[model samples]
Target: MTGDQLLIFLAGIVGGALRVGVPFLFVSLGECLTEKAGRINLGLEGVLVLSAMVAFGGSYLSGSPWIGVLAAAVAGALLATLHGLLCSLPRVNDIATGIALMLLGMGLAFYLGKPLIQPQAAQLPAIPLGFWSDSAAVRAALQINALLPIGLLLAVAMWWAFASTRAGLLVRMAGDSAHATRALGYSVSGIRIAATAGGGLIAGLGGASLTLFYPGSWNEGISSGQGLIAVALVIFARWSPLRCVGAALLFGGAGAIGPALQSVGIGWGYHLFNIVPYVLTLLILVITCRPGVIVPGSPTELSSNK
Candidate 1:
């Protein structure tokens, strides 16, 4: 490619990463928090879709994207709280419950969001990061989501909370050992449920980004399994909030590969290129899930289920 073409291609990638990575960043951070609390919430796929519909619907009704964002977060927290409560019951498997919740969330979203698919909603505004450049492509690619900065700040805050806060210590303790937490006179279930709910609230914002930002519409296929993909992302990020940011951008950039090439007039295998993120997810799992390998910073209760 020539210099100008290369610049456009690279710019497309940067824009795609910023736009597409927002959802991944939010969902993965939510999952990271849940895991840190010694719980798993695979049902976030459902939370994501449901919140997207709710956000869009709220934006359409209120004519305010921020209200929609709040509505989405509430919806996600409600569903995630249910997941937490159900999993807390005696002998309930977290994985099984999560999968069921995923299906339920999707079904409910489809049914409730039928009208939403056709309506237009107020969209989240963007931060024009390309005014410094005269190129239209540069300008378009540099329109960063307003929520992107919030997600980044949340990552930094979460990292600090995990490293130097009392609440963070309790969460870490709960995830590492239930017996130990109990010995310390704390309720493991309570701690886990609270963490799961908080994570869900954060993840709801991810859904808001999907419908109220890039693509800026509501539809059944809005997610493209990005919520599920976030599980692998969290694992790849080794459960660190700070690391999740970079990992999210990498996956986001991977997603932008096909679009970037197409923008440069290379449309061949455009659909196939979209699978890059999935392929990357598979590679991460295969490499990390070896016979005797231990993932660094994995919560101990994840394996023990105690």
Candidate 2:
């Protein structure tokens, strides 16, 4: 690659990371919060899809992308709340409930989103931070979604809360030892339910990004399973919100490689690049799956920990 090409490629990667990482960032953070509360929500894929559809529909109807985002968050929180409530019942399994919710979310999205396939919706505004760049490609790449800053702040806030707040301590306590939480007369179910719902709300924003920002469309296949992949990402991050941000950017860069290469006129094996994130996911699981190798900082009550 020539100098200009290299610059363009790098620019593409930076842009792609911001765009692709938005969903990963939200989903991983959501999973992190849920896991910290001693619950797992594997059905986030469904949440992502359903939220994407709702966001698109909302934007289309209201002519405002922000409204769409709000709608998506509400939709996600409701589904996640249902998952939390179901799992709180006796003999109910979190994993099984999550899976069922995932299916339900997808089915509902497809059924209700049939009318959304061809319609256009208002897209989120982008911030042009690369005005100094002479290259159009670089400038284009630097046009980032407004939500990126919000997500970054959210990560910082979550990390701070986890590190230095009474609520965070309670959440951590519940996850590490329900006996201790119960001893304190706190309702473990209440904490977990709230965490799960909040997590779902965050993940729903990721879905809104899918429809109102990058790709900026609503379709049955909009999610591409980023929701499921985020679960593994949280594991890799070891439940740290800041680490989740880095991991998300890495996955986003990987997802961008194929498209970046193709933009430079290198089309061979483009599909291979598209699968980089998935391949990375499998490799992470394999390496981290060793018996007796407990991940430090993981919640004790997580089934995977047991």
Candidate 3:
């Protein structure tokens, strides 16, 4: 490839990373929050799809993207709360509950999202940060959605809050050992419930970003397992919010492989490119899941440690 061609290819990769990273960022951050509180919600895939449908429907009806986002967040929180309640019950398996919630989320999204599949909703507006660039390559590289900045900001804030604040200390304690937290006169289950709900809200907002901002439309297949991948990303990121952003960008870049290849007139490997994200995810898992690698950061009471 010529110099200009290589530059264009790199620009496309960057654009793709920005475009696809938003969902992963939101979901990974949400999962991180939930995990910090000593619980896990694997039903984010369903939450994402349902939120996308609801956000689109709200936007379609009210002609207001903000309202749609709020509605989607509420819906996601409700679903997450349900999962929390079920998991909190004695003798209930959190993993099984999460799987069930995932199935339920997908079913509900499919049923309610049918009408939205045919309609076009108002898309979230983008802010161009690259006006200084006269070249097409520069412009494309800088054209990013607002969520990217928001996600990064949230990650920084959350990391600070979790590491430096009193509330963060309590959350960390609760997740590390529920019995110990209770011994210290803290409400373990209560903390987990609140965290799970907040996580759900963020995940819902992430889903809304898909319909209202990124793709700018609602459809039955809007999510495509992005939520599940986000869960994996949290593990790969070692539960650090800042690391989540980097992991999201990596996943997003992998996802851009097919389009980037096509742009360069390489069509035969399109299907192979589609698997890049999953392959990268697996690689991350293998590298991060060593016996001692993730243990230092993981909640001590968490079952995944075993």
Residue 75, candidate 2: alpha-carbon lDDT: 99
Tens digit of per-residue lDDT, candidate 1, span 218-248: 9999999988988999999999999999999
TM-score (all chains, Cα) for each model: 0.98, 0.98, 0.93
How does residue 37 of candidate 2 score in lDDT? 92
lDDT per prediction? 0.93, 0.93, 0.83
Decide which is better by TM-score, 1 or 3: 1
Weakest lDDT window of 10 consecutive positions for candidate 3: 297-306
Poorest lDDT segment (10 consecutive residues) of candidate 2:
297-306
Candidate 2 residue-wise lDDT, 148-208, digit = tens: 8989999999999999999999888888898899999999999999999999999999999
Scanning candidate 1 in windows of ten residues, the lowest lDDT window is 297-306
lDDT comparing candidate 2 with the true structure: 0.93
After TM-score superposition, the amount by which residue 275's alpha carbon in candidate 3 deviates from its true location, in angstroms, is 0.8
TM-score of 3: 0.93
Off by over 4 Å in 1: none
Model 2 segments more than 4 A misplaced: 304-306
Of models 1 and 2, which has the larger lDDT? 1
